[model samples]
Target: MTSQSSLATEDTPPGGPENPGGGSGLQAGLKNRHLSMIAIGGVIGAGLFVGSGSGIAAAGPAILISYALVGAMVVLVMRMLGEMAAARPTSGSFSAYADQALGRWAGFSIGWLYWFFWVVVLAVEATAGAKILNGWIPGVPQWGWALIVMIVLTAVNLAAVGSYGEFEFWFAGIKVVAIGAFVIVGLLAVFGVLPGSDNPGNGFGHLTDSGGFFPEGPGAILTGVLMVVFSFMGSEIVTLAAGESEDPQKAVTRATNSVIWRIGIFYLGSIFVVLTLLPWNDASILKDGSYVAALNSIGIPHAGQVMDVIVLTAVLSCLNSGLYTASRMAFSLGQRGDAPKAFAKTTSRGVPRTAILGSVVFGFLAVWFNYQWPDTVFDFLLNSSGAVALFVWLVICFTQLKMRGIILREQPEKLVVKMWLFPYLTWATIAMISFVLVYMLTDDAGREQVLLSLLVAVLVVGVSFVRERVQRVR
Candidate 1:
């Protein structure tokens, strides 16, 4: 393993005098409120609002178990990432740690793959947001709305990191409030107390009245896991954003510690309310979605429209963070000599302009592909990057395992966020991630995603090895 001192020799601190843009680097533009909201909002995605229906449909009320399982895994992974990130406080985050603990190739491959994943997400979220805008104003075509949303958010990101954080703060705040309100109302309706509830006294029978908790069978929980795992992708975005905060270490520590409640309340608490408010196998769930169906059960006026607004906020927030994350990853790669030097350059405001434009350029192309070739090229893009969340978590696990000893031997004071149970829980988290990847192969849709993602990963790793060999020869 590369010692801490050796890793320091290889890379300058972000914003250090060695930076190419006359020594300017990423600014500490994000404030405490921005970081706090980001941590809360990162855990709640449009997927929770929109995608949980299918998981509920698949696993019945037992989808709770699937969610709890995945939630535990995410908490563990974030803890490990927080441990490394708190110690080092780099925008590169896990990718930087991987360079020191694993190898340069490990860092290079994962960093680019992560960047690719978010750029592709930019296309997905932009299109989703467009569909909503076009629904409200039919005059503009769906593609036009897509273009408009992309341009607006791209401007937000390019303006300053503070602008991005401020926008996300409100977007995320809306989502947090929405979910909180839904849970409170749903609970009231369940216990026969809500004043306007249509489904008063629904009770917990919804958990087992229809066909028991595991209506599909116990194994469906695993299937539900496959469905919900991707939703957790953005939970670690705060760690990356922390590098630009005034106190990266404190930001990382707070985000990590709070992850448990974030996942518990946003995911488990909301899903429980939905399942309790209505049956898991309710046709309305499959029809209008879980949250909408739950709201309608409580006699909320225009529940579907309310959810549409919330989902739109979520899509825009995701798009904003996706661009920010992809650019930072590219910038980190540039700093480590794994990407073009221009990517490492920051503007007078300490923004990586080249990196931001490069990520958004691919994002724009991806949006075009979604419109032009929805089935062929765009479908491939989606499937090819589907498993990257697992890949990233897995890398964090291994990196933390190695980094723990190195940090202790070198700078033990930085160990503010330690992984529970040391190597044992770290190893267990690794096993769980591996098991999920292996389990994905059993389902047809998941099999295709895993295989395609593996193929892309192999190609990236091969390129990294070749690049390393050429550097050595020179």
Candidate 2:
């Protein structure tokens, strides 16, 4: 076992110093371009494509506010995470930081919770991707498509880290380009610069013209927050993926620095274009996707089909990253003695075969449950993991608060990417997360998601505490 001092050293990976067990057998196989694209595209997922529609329906143009709110929260959390990650550059990422700053139980609990979250995400992304594939080829069943996708991506992850990075690079490239094009074209149309954008609604009027900004009420902004918050879940994939990059510290710092623009342009910018180009009340935005509906409004032919392809890419990217992340987290747990040591074992290729297979096994079962009892099993899985992003963000905030003081006192030179405003903004971000959680409980639509997530969190915590007590007795 490695000491905490060894784990805290720079220029090494997750396990400890540059020793036999260091990095837990993971390799720094990802290239610069792969790191760049993962940094840019990591946050852009199928959620923005499919789920934003519902958020728009719930909060109308005010949904933009929802995106901004969650985007700010994510930016703050990522900044905090970036500070620690740049310093230590752990594959465990937040869990490792939590262990250093909080306790072993914090690391164990959050690590397992994060693993659970992503394993379920694998099933969700696989199912979502399968639907798009099945639509294109009706001969293949949805379950078959889901299985194929999971298997292919699983192979990519197991083959090597570079393969996963290459695949995600392209997947995220398509998404980034698609959204960037949408923003440019939609902005042109909004300003009546596009040739066929002579329609009366082709301006900023739709934002307020459609029952005002808060169509439902001011409460709907919070509702929109709840609806859109989950869309921002995948942003942390960059930090996790950075662990396998050639320069983990540089990768984390670069990714952290660029997060603000990514969220602004890809999320808020694109959504702004959609609201301006089409009325928020339009059925197609929800019936179809917000982006597709906006494209269709501007006479873009086969817009829905085009978007379906991009959404598929996003889904596949999510599944690929999910497997990589969960396996890495499991491997970290093993390294820290929080998980079975077998998971710390890896193939010659530096792939955590045991960890990856364990995560995939649960993913396949979730996909099976999704097919067998779509409503009950899948819904429960979805809700149980729904609020984990928020939970993770909360932990990041607190961990940064404690870790910041330590960094400043013990390792002042390690402060590469510091959080703005020190503890002030950090406290504000925490309060904001608390408000969202409390808001979730009050809102009937989000209450179940919050409750189920809390149950899973409590269960993990309980298990962590039990394990700690047993170890002490032993």
Candidate 3:
């Protein structure tokens, strides 16, 4: 199950009657630009825009360190994932690699868990996006707006991979542009360059001037990590999306190569501007959000309103990509015989119609549960999937460690995007994630997320084991 053997026939024809849903496979409609943008835009999410306010408030300016730590961890994980993805380029991404490198149990558990995570994200993002729309158009009820957002994005994904890519391209473009402008303008204002403002820019004093970077105490940095790490959840979309690109290996390579600079510029760079423009303790940051507060500090009119529009775009982008990621994972699982055969079915346009519809149906139901019991069912769904990103990364690191050996021995040629320090950094990443998980248990807010996620993980693994045993008996 080395990548070389798994992807030996990239152009092979579809499965025959014996494999019901594996008829015509997914189309490679994603272009070079699509991959590049997905790589760039996937890192910029609504979390960075909205959630950072709370991070800044918690860890003060030192939240930058929290982001840097998590960012580095993610970069390593993606490198490892990119290595496997470049070698195989399956729509299942790490899950497929896990199947080959680990066992069917690992693949089945992770694929289904990842699918569950994103489908839940579909409901969350849909509702978040709907709130913005409902704000603009008061006539539409919140649920109606949620339904509209889900239906529209579902249509885009069901059309074709290219449609998803193109829509994500623009959605991500808006986020990139908005953040880029925010960083630029905030920098200019930091140096007292903005017109009509005599304020001798706050400079770097904000990092220490208030109560110092660790005003909230050193422990808060880990708390900040808990708050911000989830923002990095969708960064793996590049690896997932690359499977549909015209040249997947090239896409994976380029995406992997650019992750460092992307995280540096987008996450650290933007947060740097925000902290410099205003103190981390600035009440406005907590009230108006870090980005909007930065905008307001420079006297930008309607900064909050402007940020709402950008946040809406980010929400829509997340929903669109979430649906795409979940459906593709389901499709891949079906192809691997880990899911229902119907999930692997594709339309004439090469869209996984059944997979997309099935994921959306669950998303719609989740949205209903959210409206009906925001405190009960929705909260459980949210907490249960909250830590799956960390779990997925853990699986990727272990898979790559094993897969790396196989790739090196069997097919050294597929090592275009190798993980740095090989087994060393891979092991370090696992340790770091484990430390984070352990650290999460010490806090009330993070404790439930980790516990619930572990519960879900255990349940999925149990099901995989049962499935394997049942198949063996037959």
Candidate 4:
């Protein structure tokens, strides 16, 4: 374990982490079980269910390659982060690593970008979740449901880390079980094992016949990459949550070691089944999202309702994780003195109460946008964040590359969860992420949204940079 004294900088004192409600006897708030589940389910967001349809449409069955390609990048990036996180777990896992490896400016800029990313995400989740609920219960306006969702999740976040863990554990568990079950059933149908199955399983034929591997052409796959990368966004939640673990280092190692496989199987496996069982360009799936089509094709009764419920659960889970992520990132910033110190405050339950509540305000406003201006602000919010995902990922890669040597010099044994090929994979991942960013900027379908997102990301980065410069001069 890293010496507690070493953990403290000017921002964080030696005795405890930067807490909002002063130090509370909340026992670090979460245990191994909660950490494990949040680590698992936290990454499986609505993207798997909804956003995948667009990706498949763009690249056809060959979209699997897109997912695999991005997944490889994720594996390498997480491995890099895992090395640092396992050495010294802290609330600001990646940011802290960036600070140690790069400089105060790098951490300050990236950390704020990450925090901004999730605050926007908080709104997106609420709006997405509220849409499903609003349809079911018309009397409750969509905006009203959004408010309810944010307030409720905010309450969960404020309750305590243990409670947050418990909530996320179950939320993530439901998704794992549902998607896992979907994969098993889909596989049976693929092998012609499902009872009374009349429809012919197309298997690998769907992957090629629809558009062939390069159906939309090599150029289209790049467009597909723009959408596909967003689905992989939540996988790093494990690293962030690991900071609160009782044994932070071990938890970081275990979570990072396990996440690559989990994300690969769940995401790639499910998408494979979807494309194999039904063509990528299938009308029903394209019009209504892939999950709906997969469920309905398998002869699941009330596929729409079933998927609506599943997606609703996903939205809530994402919202829950969004609030948690944003709060922690803010808390990290505050503790590091990168932001106002008030954000570092923790409640009696060791929860970052102010940050949690403050983050949800965006969620509420997002809900309002979804209800009153769905076509304008809400859609822009939805599309804008897709590019920012790439930005956050790129920063992680650079931070890791710079920090690896410092970490090894300080604590060599922490390399147990290290990325294979060391700097090679790290640099490769950086190149891959950079390619995705450039591709997003070029893709016709994603051009406006990506451009706008890039602008927002730059503004945030620039502000953070200037703030640091001023501080240094002072």
Candidate 5:
């Protein structure tokens, strides 16, 4: 295994030698401003906008705790990723580190699983954006909207990496502005300072008013954790993108350092506004969704429509990043010889056309399944990919453990962004992730998701070993 890993590491240097100018064939198209927005906007997903309602319904006001817990975990995971990425930035990100630290199977399995997760995300976001667009214009069918979204984003990705960054910069900027405005308005209403506000200075009373913070019991916090954890999936996208930036090291360092404020303001802060503006058990929360309901409480006219526009932007942003992320992972896999060689080939402009098309093709198929079999096949795809965020975080913990020692031995100065407490916190994160997976088994819906995701993960790991054996024989 050691020999195999060493050989694999040598064969696939960081980013590969495909382009003489940089680490990889990818160009330095992402500017510092683009990186800043990507880091800020990546945390504020459509899930926080739409899906948090169910989490609030499940855990009541304690949902804030759920968001905080998940937020902290993401911070630690990103720090580990930043340490490696800053030391040696690459589009492959943690997968490349896994190859060097653990073995070939580790890198191959996680890379493909991460790729699978994003492609599925593409379909989900496409459908979501389609629903909103179709509601606005009923003449175009939902499928038509989905097709249009998929094609437009695919073109943006294929054109150049900068197009993706530029589009994301605007998309993420809108989301940040929307949430920041919401938090500000919510605070005003909560303090009875906003003129013409219906919700007059309830303060934290709503936190305990309905059934108390833990209406469902303290156990509900864990349930909320399970519910809200996936919303944080896109937070690490900055690390993957750092490879294509002009100063990969600085971009990663800045992103890693700012993760705390981003999550605090966006997830925790926005959710705090919602809880304070209205009771957790308010019918409007579950009925209209959290953000929209909060806006309605403050006498914001057309709150639903306003939120629809924001959520649609978020969905399109996710779809855009999803396609870019999945394609880049494919390109990285190809660079390492884990995938088709053509995937590593880039256009003159440094766009991985083949990899982008391959990922989008799968995404289009997933969209078709979503339309044709919303409950059966499509549901399975969702469940099978549901636990991937946890899986990726766990791998980063383990990879960082091994990688920390390697870096210290070879070149300690590269450790610009270290994991907080070394092996101790890393182990703690692994334990937390393991506990969540085990906790997931107790709930019917979570159980199905965990089992299905595990089935797919096991199958992928098996394939990696088999491929390794075949290579050894040859």
Candidate 6:
């Protein structure tokens, strides 16, 4: 796979994706820190902040267990990805791993589905960001703001990958700092340190007071799991970033090694603070959002406005990452011949301009869809892309299992970040993903979203098969 291929050219490196450069875009100047924060920050989207409020409302404080369950699953998946990425670094990322370990078809299927998911996410975040912008500048229409935001991020990506990374770093940094402050203030309020946060059963009582853990029973926790998994979706960006970082191997190590702490700080820490501050069923928890409620309880002036700023930053960060990721996935597919060869070209600065443009065009269309058919088309987009996180994670597991054997047999030297307990942990994580999918099927609220996403997955698989059959006859 490394040294032999019909498509191989003189300029191609030993283990690199095809590099038909001086045609498309510039090189990514993102350093380790920029890349690292982008990786970490991507995981801390609005889902962790505002969306979790709904998840909490569903499961009460028991949602902590829900987050932990999803977090553990994510950690395992990242470790598997880290092992493969550490061994081989390419901008193609996990799709490359799938191609090498599974087959070209697996890579093509996952790449396109992941790309579709991001494009929809881009539109979703754009709408979300525009709402925030419109609130601040009422003179502008929401639709107009959405258009401007999309164009701005698209230009930033075309400018350079580092620009995207730098922007993401600051956006993510502000979110992290804001959440950290929320935790501190919430803790003070929970303990009745604040002047006005004195509720009937304050402090730790909130965790168990509302129906004594699992208020809505275990089923609600399962429902919360469906919502919580999306929060963990962004962590995989680290493996993607590793491909562009100065030290791909080190990037993987840092990404995987830090997974535990990320879960601890970002997921578990913030969540612990939330449950402590307010019961999951409180009306304010649903209406004002957990972070806002926490801030308000702490007597922070203009807490709602402060939280609005954080949420808006999160939306922009998600928007930037969505465009960057979709383009890279398409570029990887093109380089592998799963997509049009034109997408394989790179700019003088080493960027994939064609792929970037294609992704942005698709995103721009989705943005239009939000306005033109805000009622139905936007709903379909959301449903169709919602379940892709499971698909990507499952592919990662299968790819890891395949790659693990190949590495141990052919290149035992490349096992720095091995999955603990070898095949055991791998099997367990696969089971967890399967369970999530099955539970999703039974979940009335989340069922349609998963099924629609599966339909999109099936179409991608069918198309890849047809494409291969056509090539054979040609």
lDDT of 1 by residue, 371-468 (tens): 99999999999999999999999999999999899889988998999999988999999999999999999999999999999999999999989987
Please give the lDDT score at residue 4 for candidate 6.
23
The sequence of per-residue lDDT tens digits that candidate 4 reaches over residues 1-474 is: 121222473123213453543754124567888878877776688888988998888788778888888888877777877877777677787877777666776677778777777887877778778788989999998778888888888888888877778888888888999999999998888777898654377667777876576788877666666777777787788777776767767777877888777877789999999987887778987897898888778788888898888888888888888888888888777777777777778765677777676667766676677778878887787766657677777778887776677667876876677778877877888888777766666667567767877777777768877876796699
User: Model-by-model lDDT, in order?
Assistant: 0.89, 0.86, 0.86, 0.76, 0.90, 0.80
* Per-residue error (Å), model 2, residue 287: 1.9
How displaced is residue 379 in candidate 5, in Å?
1.2
Tell me each candidate's TM-score.
Answer: 0.97, 0.95, 0.96, 0.92, 0.96, 0.94
| TM-score (C-alpha) between model 6 and the true structure | 0.94
Q: Which residue pairs clash in candidate 1?
A: none
True lDDT of residue 63, candidate 5:
92
Q: What residue runs in model 2 are displaced by over 4 Å at the alpha carbon?
A: 1-24, 196-201
Candidate with more favorable, higher TM-score: 4 or 5:
5
Output the worst ten-in-a-row residue range by lDDT, candidate 6: 2-11
Return the lDDT, model 2, position 408: 84
Candidate 4 yields a Cα-based lDDT of: 0.76
TM-score of 3: 0.96
Identify the candidate with maximal TM-score. Answer: 1
Name the TM-score of candidate 2: 0.95
Flag clash pairs in model 4. 19-345, 19-346, 20-345, 20-346, 21-346, 21-347, 211-215
